[model samples]
Target: MKDLLIGVDIGGTTIKHGIITKEGTLIDKWEIDTDITNHGENVPYDIWNSIKTRLTDLQIGYDRLIGIGVGAPGFIDPISGVVAIAVNIGWHDFNLKEILENLSNLPVYIDNDANIAALGENWKGSGQLVSNMLAVTLGTGVGGGIIANGQILTGTNGTGAEIGHMTVIPENGYHCNCGRTGCLETIASATGFVRVAKQWIEEGKADSLKVRLQEQGNLSTKDIFEIARSGDESTNQLIEYILDHLGLALANLAVTLNPAKIVIGGGVSKAGEQLSKPLQKSFDKYALPRAKEACEIVIADLGNDAGIFGGAFLALQKS
Candidate 1:
């Protein structure tokens, strides 16, 4: 029988799983809404059942399955398969690997979602060229993973590349979900853009976005981008705010890590060069000369499937 691998990406609101061949093609996959309200203790069983049902539906025998690789949102101990903490998922000191191994009777591997995303990019997507690169994901919040010499640099406590929580501006900025002020995510993330825009709209600033949001119901970060494209004054200002912070953050990372490249992924990156242009300009100005010369920042080649491919890479390595 041909060998198969299982890759899971767990998020705050959904759990995405996929089956893949050794070549990194996603053969089949599905997503389930995560009910974190039940607390983190219940996540493993839910994941186990989900996988079991999928396997049964595919009619794949257990012997052909090699191993399972999981990417979850939290500080994970990859060696022990324990999640030290996940504020969004409500998990603390949870034994994820043990539960999955016991349920499926298969070997399991786990790591933070950002690390897995970087692995995904490295395996079949953007980072294939360079050995040292940083993958920064601009999701609901910012998540990052650092890779050096084709291996994840998860630092002590498996939480090294917590770039989102890094302080960009020292004394003045909004509070982040991680209980810090002036975090990169507080200004650069999807939620942050909307927060800044909504406040401006509520203040009755004159712009097309206010009219658009009033008609389109709830305003998303994407909506802000759309309005900016159409020449909305307030929307343009919001994009400027985001680009300034995002560029400054990248410059800071560039100076410190000096990675060969910076691969940007996640939903907000969909803005493409509209976002990248200003960000690149800012990096050119702010980053050190050698650091800027050493690195090339690019959009992630893989779209939503980076996580799946990354997870499959993890599984295949184990097999």
Candidate 2:
């Protein structure tokens, strides 16, 4: 019926693909491992080929497709359709739009992963109907997407609302992948949480976390939260520090954007209310009273599918 859209979200290890209705209903979805063996030079061809095979297997005619939308992690230039850099995916100056368009002979659009996620959440998840909203993802690294006056704000070079790179700690902070020191990502991300916990253990501030780390040979944000629940004062303190910095960063964004909702997603958010309650306490400490009172913090409902929905939204809007 020409009412279907193809949505592709490229991650470091997996590439997620979806067929969604024009109204944002995901009809079918699947994932494929990312082949990064050769600097990702063959990734584009693989993605397009996979989509065609899936369509044939599903008995869907090419006439039913309208366009394709893609979301990836990087400094995406939506205007140029070139991914300037995606460290995790090994794509630099990748002309994503032209390749997809030429291969499929269909309209293709792309945006930053976080930005598409924000659009998806606002359109169908917790931030629905809000013209002003913010979506923050706390995973291996932090990601931010901002919506203002009903439009996604992709400023010049598509770096707008990149809260992860914000300099929350100006001195002696852990190094970020972006080559900066003391970024919020070095404090609020899962990687950041582990780094801080390791530092605390070395400083004799945490005993349970150190023991757990040794037993497991590694640590995660989940482990930290679990330990805190078991009455480990050190782990609790570490959680507080991470959340407090996350809160402070969100607060600064809240005061500036004055968004009606702040939707938190990603791996750390899996902790749920255990993460939100204390985070709200820390946010109230720094946010302006009006901003704090106006914004409602909530968890994302769509989980990982946000990107697929968001990618469909991009196709609907741009093509």
Lowest summed lDDT window (length 10), candidate 1? 204-213
Model 2 over residues 1-319: C-alpha lDDT tens digits?
7999998888999999999999888889999999887778777888999999999999999899889889888999998789999888888899988988899998999899999899888877889859999999999889999999988899988999899999998888789888989999998998899999999999989999999989999998899999999988878888988889889989999989999999999999999998999898999999999999999999999899988888888888886
**Predicted structure 2, TM vs. truth:** 0.97
User: What local distance difference test score does each model get?
Assistant: 0.85, 0.90
**For each predicted model, how many residue pairs clash, with residues at least 3 apart or on different chains?**
1, 0
RMSD of each: 2.2, 1.2
Candidate with maximal TM-score:
2
lDDT of 1 by residue, 1-319 (tens): 7588888899888888889887787779898888787676777888889888988998888887888889988899988999999888998898899999999898988989999989898888878747889999988889899988777888878988999998887897889988879898887888988877877878877367778778988788888888788877667777886788788888888888889989999999999987888789878878999999999988998877777777777877766
